[model samples]
Target: MTSSQIQVPAQEEGGATILEIGQQPDAWREVGGETDEGLARFLRGITERPGLRVILTGAGSSAFIGQIAAPALRRHLGCRVEPIATTDIVAAPRDHLEPDTPTLMVSFGRSGNSPESLATTALADELVTDIWHLVYTCDRTGELGRAHRDRANSRVVYLPERTNDTGFAMTSSLTSMLLSCLLTLGPAGRGNVEALAQAAEHVATLQPDIRALAQSGPQRIVYLGSGALAGLAQESALKLLELTAGVVVTYFDSPLGFRHGPKSVLDGCTLVVVYVSNDPYTRRYDLDIVAELRAQLSPDAVRVLSCEPIPQELGTATVLPGLAHLDDAQAALPYLVFAQYLALFTALEHGKTPDNPFPSGEVSRVVQGVTIHPISPSDLEAR
Candidate 1:
């Protein structure tokens, strides 16, 4: 059924989650409109610097945004681009930070209050002699946003207020920040944003089939992709795990990477979803795995999410027609909608609350129980 026909109850446990997921299309448009000249000028100045390296960071789903965007940004800016998680940076600052490298830290946070996110910014200042920040967050009042608003070396770009998702899982917030980064720092433009929004609206039409599969009772779900799409696969896996509160097992990997050893997770009770890349060269590897899996598994066991059509023997496909021109990084926005829907329906089918899956506080919307240890200049010198 279409999104309008899904009929979520007013007081439903996952009502907010469903609403937030549906709101992404419009929120993305706002991202396009909000890409001001000042942000673009700031980024241009940083990219022109000698010996520059860009690091994209966040924690959890927020971190996945950097993974998906780094490849495209690296190509656009012609500089070193790395996607490092705030969790990793906080735990091992010396490994990822350089004392003299000119670096731009693009921090993505839904709530802007994640402890690791906050700590990583401070650590960058302490560790890097030449550092700049481009902070993208949903909450204006959040610590990350507040901390960087007036800083000399940082610029805070707040997305539309509604993009600050109230649900336990990030739906609108993730895509909004991702699109903002692409439009401002990467090669995406207003036209790309419009196309992505249209494609995401079309994803709602596939929900009926996605919901059918969710109800079919698969014990395990696997997502596979390549390049930037591999990061999309990772985020897709997290959405399912978080919404189900660990009731369902999930895994993610690149299509070729899966064959090395990870493909052993496949079984009659498992479902595999592949995010097909838009690039012709990368699409070859994606199709190879889909072909191999269909040969060994049930014809209905594998699903393909792509921008173009495949051979008839490939089984069911969710083909979004207008996205063929965009590269895999830009195409990632609509491709993610399908994954989001699958996770939402799977949680509903399993009788879990999509909004508050971990009601007992096993996990929280903003992470909990993290202690940001103090690190000094002496700590770096001793090392």
Candidate 2:
């Protein structure tokens, strides 16, 4: 169903998430129109500097995008590109920051209002001498978004207007910003539009099936993947846990890691979703885990998402379609559509609103109650 078409109890209306999720295909197309020459020069600048370091920073789902992008981008740039959360940087700047190294702090935020996002940027300005900012956000109007638009070394990439999510949870906002980073980082992201278009069209057709599967009300959920998909797996887990308000127990880890101590969580009622990696080597481990889980649990217990044709041959497992034509980084957007739908349908099954999942005032659309304390000179010295 389209976002606006989703029906929930009057007390639990959640149209924002549904609409956000549905509009992602459009957001994918729209964000492509934006271009920043300064941002382009900064990317080239990284290659020219000998000791330059790139730090991809954000909070919550925004942070996960950094995890997904850093590894791929590091290889693409052939330099040190690290994914460190603004949450961590704000709390302990000494370990993550260095005044001697030329640093580029790439900040990803949905609203750009979170105290830490800007606070972390501020900290960089104070502690690092040769610091630059490349900020990609859905809301160019928010405090962090507008704060540094004129900085000589900084570049702000404001995505399509529709991407600034009105929903409590980030749907288009998350994927679009993540896609933007991938698009900026390397060749892998350059070909994403064609692949994302196909995947979006494909996902639109599968919503009914996905919704039906989610209504079964599995008591527990597990998401597994390898490489960049591993980070997306964590974001998916967070989406469900937040939407369900902790009513459902969820866990995320890599396929091989699941076998170590985590495999005990599996049971008859547990639904396991595996994001089959686009990498051939990683795909083998993913398939192996699926085989093991299906053999140990029922074949019905495990679900695999992949672009591989061979998964169709696995009779015991349910295979969700993926965009195999795109590389892992470029294809992450389409693969994430499945996770977004799962969270949406799962929340609705319980008559809960996916948009504003938590009314307890405990969790919020924007993180609240944060105290951005000043980092002292003493704190700057690494212990």
Candidate 3:
């Protein structure tokens, strides 16, 4: 059965539910056997065009997806790959777009209804002579998908039906979209996709363990990642904060970048979660930070969760495996699931509803209260 097919038991009043969303990683196995030929075909069409400069754009969580995908695409495709927030693109098109450039824009959206999302796509068409769009969205009938229908240079990849999550926070949708992108651009002829999917499923089984750790102690959380994973770190931090309704003060930093200034944020109450890379060069930086933190941090006061096992020198209190060899985008699935588990546990600890943590009504699943401005003639002429 698919992950979505598994029913979550109802939670007792003012108590944590036995069904942990973080374990969705284990459900990835259901998708493992399937081949992503559609995504591969789409990538081939985009890459075949000469002089293609690719822009991966999105907003909020979707923007974080682009950030993680950018580095991997640049390294593997040997093409210029940039991850730009749709908000930024809409506000300053000239800064991100080139009029004469042949561009392939990859957009990610959950609802695909964000105002900036449609505006950014329109801006690309208006400013660039040769612009092609690849939209990855969970909602098939949403604005982004509908906008691409009659357009010759545009294609929309609706995520698996199961990915259309009803929950306020994105869970399954994020992983499916990120995995689709990895298969689209990753090394060809290697069946690591199945392995990656299996790993995700395995992590799902560890949700209970993750929740236990998250509920143990440490009110402050710090996430460290490098390269493409840096975006994953940010997303992870945001997920914990949002799901817990800011019950946990969270921070994210690049492994090396953390030492520069952000390391000061780590203290006795901090729980440091590190997404270690398989790449040796990047892993060294991640390990180094862990080493420094260990020396200064009291073992009882600070909690450390590493995605992979570190040497004895780093002294990680908890290690979760099955992340090695996976790309940062794909690795993010298990890590995200773990964060969700932590958030839920933390929320329950504070007597908050994991489903709707912000009982005060400050935030909505779909953001509200933003006014969009029309592009002016002066803006066009400047480009």
Candidate 4:
């Protein structure tokens, strides 16, 4: 069954978002091809430093990039890597910062103008005595890039200008920064950037099937994954919530974690989407949940996405070929594109404007109504 679908064109309200979502493949190609010697030196220095810790920070959707990249970055860099949101750093700097540790704070921003974005970086400078800054932003003119560009001990990498999404949600901007960060901070290999982009392009073609899923009128949506894909699930859930303007309730959990009481949210009106892992060990747990959900729910109510095909009796799957060799983190790029497309068509299904879901401005493109309080040296002393 199909509803009156709103096509994506320049004239529609969702045109920017639709175009941005489609532009990701090209944008990724550009980011993946870019090389920066200074940025390399900055990262190389961090890797060589003894007792160094890397902290990835951002706000809202921007923050999820860190969550998606942290595990792989840690394994490749051989150091402590943590994904701490800029919101958390702003609200509770003391708990997350280490004054004496040699730290490299990687900041990911779409606009790079969010109050928390600047505030968190400022707090890191004040709190971490021996610290360096690595920034990835789509906006070259944004305060986050401008403020740190010329500063000593700081290196800023600006992604392709088009990645500065004009739409309300972070689409190309999020994925570009995540890709650039991984290519720069991860191991020496540049990876198969062309293949990754091609996989994302393939996901874009699945729009028709995805739109049908959206049109099914499920009141609840759940996204589940394991490892880095778990973080991808969080971002996937956010896309649905943002595009639908909170009309559709969404939940995200790790495949194994869902068994611990979180699975009770399932109902007849719910649709469950699972991202099966490429790792042999992790795939076992991911498939276990998918099998369990298929047994309990109608086959139509569950969907599985994997890099390779699963058993037919387990149910239908959207298999992204050529990506089976990718680590879970790299695989997240195409998985995210699928989630974005589903969110877009779902927004149109509900007759909501994808570009600006909240017409009344209850929520905004860049967050509003945040007050960044100054953290004085005395405040630190008291704590």
The alpha-carbon RMSD values of the candidates against the true structure, listed in the order shown, are 2.9, 2.8, 3.0, 4.0
On the 0 to 100 scale, the lDDT of residue 272 in model 1 is 92
How does each model score on lDDT? 0.90, 0.81, 0.73, 0.89
Deviation from native of the Cα of residue 225 in model 2, angstroms: 0.8
In candidate 2, which residue pairs get closer than 3 Å at backbone N, Cα or C atoms, i.e. clash? 3-18
Off by over 4 Å in 1: 1-13, 381-383
Per-residue error for 381 in candidate 4, Å, reads: 3.5
Question: Which regions of candidate 2 are displaced past 4 Å?
Answer: 1-14, 189-191, 311-313, 316-322
For candidate 2, the lDDT comes to 0.81
lDDT of 4 by residue, 228-330 (tens): 8988999999999999999999999998899899999999999999999989999999888888998898888888999999887787899998988888888
Model 2, residue 266: distance off in Å is 1.3
How would you encode candidate 1's per-residue C-alpha lDDT over 38-140 as one tens digit per residue? 7778778889998899999999999999999988999988999999999999999999999899999999999889999999999999889999999999998
State TM-scores per candidate.
0.96, 0.93, 0.89, 0.96
TM-score of 3: 0.89
Predict model 3's lDDT versus the native.
0.73
What ranking of all candidate models by TM-score puts the best one first? Answer: 1, 4, 2, 3
Per-residue lDDT tens digits for candidate 2, residues 1-383, read 54355553353434767767877887888777567776787678765788778999999999998888887888877779998999999988887888888898899999899999999999999989989898988886888879878888788888887788877777888888888887777655444576676677688788888888788779899999888888888988998888888888999999999989998998778999888877888889988888888878776778777776545455443333446655676667777888888888888888777777777787999999999998787865657
Q: Runs in model 4 with CA error above 4 Å? A: 1-13
Error of 3 at 280 (Å): 0.9
Ranking by lDDT: 1, 4, 2, 3
lDDT score at residue 108, model 1, on the 0-100 scale: 99
Q: What tens-digit string does per-residue lDDT give for candidate 3 at 1-383? A: 76557775443232223243543443354344446576567668888777789999988888888888788788778888899999899888888899898899999988888888888999899889989898888898899999995677888877766676666667777777776666666442236555555555665676667667666776898888888779888888888788778878999998778888878887777877777776778778877776777677755444454556778765654554655666666666666666666666666666667666666779877667666787778867753
